[model samples]
Target: MKPSFTFSSNSIRLSYVSWICIFIVLLITISLLPIIWRGLEDFNPSDDYRLPYELSYDYWMFSCWCKYACSNYPIVMIGDSVVWGQYVGLKETLPYYLNELEKTNQNYPLCANLGVDGIHPSAMLGLIKYYGKSISNKHVILHLNLLWMSSKKHDLSDTEEFRFNHPRLVPQFYPKIPSYKAKFPQRANIIVERYVPFSSWVSHLRLNYYENMDIGNWTMQYPYRNPFNAITFQIPYPEDKPHSEPISWIERGMTKQDFPWVSIDESFQWDSFKKVIKLLQSRKNKVFVIIGPFNPYILTDESLNRYKAMKKDMENWLKNEGISYVSPSDLPNEFYADASHPLKVGYEMIAKELVETESFKNWLDK
Candidate 1:
């Protein structure tokens, strides 16, 4: 004989056993909430890991740019932080400046900035693999910084443990590096991060969100958060700072003996750079490699020589390959935003120079 269950207002009153079951179910749902939220989003664990040049925040910000640019088919610009235009407003960025130039001059195709900070030649390949298909057949202006090739051999490892700061999550494609408690005190932060829905936490925090609450297309801006405090505040430019005064960069110290830069002629980064160029060519994209100007004022004599050599070698390579490029002459330090990145004046100078170039004009007309 089997026992039959019956329900009545009084008879089915909440019992200890029934209440315990309800609590257990609720607890399980709460624990699994973040996991469930993560599964629904566009987040990828393997690509989220940080390298020296790459940061977790950079990937997220770049993803936003990719999503926006993929649908527009604008002329895409690819490169490192200089190209990324860090510490500047979106309006002040290179792509924005180029587009503004296009609007004024009636250029054929508008430029889209797809630059990300800490992007080496190898990482650029990764970005192309992830987002290149979206901009296929479009003209791409690649900012080739010689410093990318000068990375040390040991710095080239994409799989090293300390390269990433985030605690290892269930990887999508690659194996994860373990997170030690000593190193990553907040190893489980991913759970909370993933559990929270984008609408709840991420979207509201964007630079555009602060600019306007409309949640328009251009939501990502220069993340002006305090590195130490994680506080997002407006950047205060000193009133006395002359428009001609260039912002100093900590990396300007790299020109000293402490920072050794070897020739990148035989580097893993060089191979990766070649691979990216080939990949772009295969896709029938017209590639224009632009060599941006460096801050000559801060460079030591040795560093200056290194820069010149790199530039000459690059020119040789481009000449051999029959690639069209715009190599800007050295500019005053006042034109720079930092050690590497350009200010508004500098970016405008680059665009103007490219516009003046017959090769660039020929490429655009085609």
Candidate 2:
């Protein structure tokens, strides 16, 4: 025999209402978290500031930075690690040099560095589309690195699973990345984060405070430690130093080799890059493109010929679009850090070339 428990209709209705109230409270709290987090930190970024290297994957923080830059700066330099100055210090980047040049004329239009490491055109498309709403009605200096089209795998045309940077920034499902093996749930979560501030805020906490781990995993790893103790309430600053010693690729033992360059028509990266330009233009951005001064010195003759043909086609397209651009002549071999990235002096030279170019000067004047 078992004891029976019963509830009146009114009592059952009250229980349901209690759960509903609890759910509403939870929803409101989650939505308010991102706002609360923003208030907790005073994020007045300096003129020379780029996104901290560690926070590169934190799109929420990127959004915050982008908004601030858009509001403050008239010119924003957007691209991958090349523009970010991989082998140069914070003050040695292209944007910094551009700003220094601008000082001779006027200081009103300061250039902001919005580059992220390993951000290929595909991820870049997603990044600007979702996180860069504040960039409209501004002057954009967009960099196009040809190294991404130098191979099938680099262009993301290979249909095999492999690791790539900023998976969270790329399209998850529709244009499938055969190499991206994230399961459905993970893909869905990524989509949610793009639209939901709360989800991204949680990710910021995980990245900055919890050793890049989720609360559950962090707890398991630190068994007896209090989870709250993990948060230091301080955002880590990016070191102003270069990631690599400022050395030319030749000095690093890199040799000239034949690259299996992909054609512009078949290039996935090229297509994505065109779309990025269109997206920026649609937002009323005055777009100026800087095609890479790729290290022609490091290319075998055949590879160099193929690269030249590809570059010519790109120039023709830009001309048809009436877009202002500059494909700077390659710097001396000693100026190259690798096939695409420039050394510190290389950045300075590139900036000087840009300011001296008739087209670049015209765009700036406008």
**TM-score for each candidate, following the candidate numbering:** 0.59, 0.93
Instruction: Report the backbone clash tally of model 2.
Output: 0
- CA lDDT of every candidate: 0.56, 0.89
- Kindly list the per-residue Cα lDDT of model 1 for residues 1-366, writing each as its tens digit: 665975456665789999999999987775675345434444331111111122323333445445456456457788866766655555566666677667866543377667656666766775665434555677888887765543353225333333522222222223222322223334355434434434223432343224323334333343454332432332222122222334545434333322245555555556667778888988888888887666666567777777678678878888799888888866665665555667767877777777779988888876
Which sections of candidate 1 miss by over 4 Å? 1-64, 105-109, 151-246, 249-259
- For model 1, the local distance difference test gives 0.56
Provide the lowest-lDDT 10-residue window in model 2. 5-14
What C-alpha lDDT, on a 0 to 100 scale, does residue 130 get in candidate 1? 48
Worst 10 residues of 1 by lDDT: 45-54
Error of 2 at 139 (Å): 0.7
The most accurate candidate by TM-score is 2
Most lDDT-accurate candidate: 2
How accurate locally is residue 38 in candidate 2, as Cα lDDT from 0 to 100? 79
Expressed as tens digits, the lDDT of each residue in 1-366 for candidate 2 is 665966456543558888999999999999998888876866777778888888889888888889889999989989999998899998999999999988877756479999988899999999999988888999999999999999888888778876888888888997877677899999999999989889889888998888899999999999999998877767777689998888999899999979888898998889999999999999999999999969999999999999999999999999999999999877988999889999999899999999999999899878
